[model samples]
Target: MVGRPLPLRDLGFRSTMELVAEMPKVVRVCPNGKGSVVLKGEA
Candidate 1:
């Protein structure tokens, strides 16, 4: 999103929502880089 569109296509995705849906498999809900919650999370 910040640099190029090719990477998204390379990943075989056409939308941001498609990318986001796969995020949880590779990312955790906690461990925020700045140590704050922009959105609520379950304990």
Candidate 2:
């Protein structure tokens, strides 16, 4: 294990777009701006 696991609320996220859209405004203020990632769920 490395970083603390993402919160369970994050695990239940439905779509990458939804996640990207839902990110806090402060986080989206990064110099690099909004980013996207694919979230895979356990079987």
Candidate 3:
């Protein structure tokens, strides 16, 4: 079966398509009122 949906950080377009399905502790954190997403993961 297909795994979890790929995160935005691992999404890209290149000469070839490689999926970096690294599961991270994602959270909706607004650090100092900045971004909305935080991905503490590996590549």
RMSD of 3: 11.0
Measured with C-alpha atoms, the lDDT of residue 11 in candidate 3 is 56
Question: For residue 37, what is the lDDT in candidate 1?
Answer: 30
Error of 1 at 42 (Å): 10
- Kindly give the number of clashing pairs for every candidate: 0, 0, 0
- For each candidate in the order shown, give its overall lDDT on alpha carbons: 0.57, 0.49, 0.36
Q: Write the per-residue lDDT of candidate 2 for residues 18-40, one digit (tens) a residue.
A: 56556655234233344644433
TM values, all candidates: 0.38, 0.28, 0.16
Give a tens-digit lDDT track for model 1, residues 1-43.
5675647677888875566556765544444688763332334
Pitting candidate 2 against candidate 3, the one with the higher TM-score is 2
State the lDDT of candidate 3 residue by residue for 1-43, as single tens digits. 2696545455553221223222223322234556443433433
Q: Whose TM-score is greatest here?
A: 1
Candidate 2 Cα deviation (angstroms), residue 35: 18
Q: Residue pairs in steric clash, candidate 3?
A: none
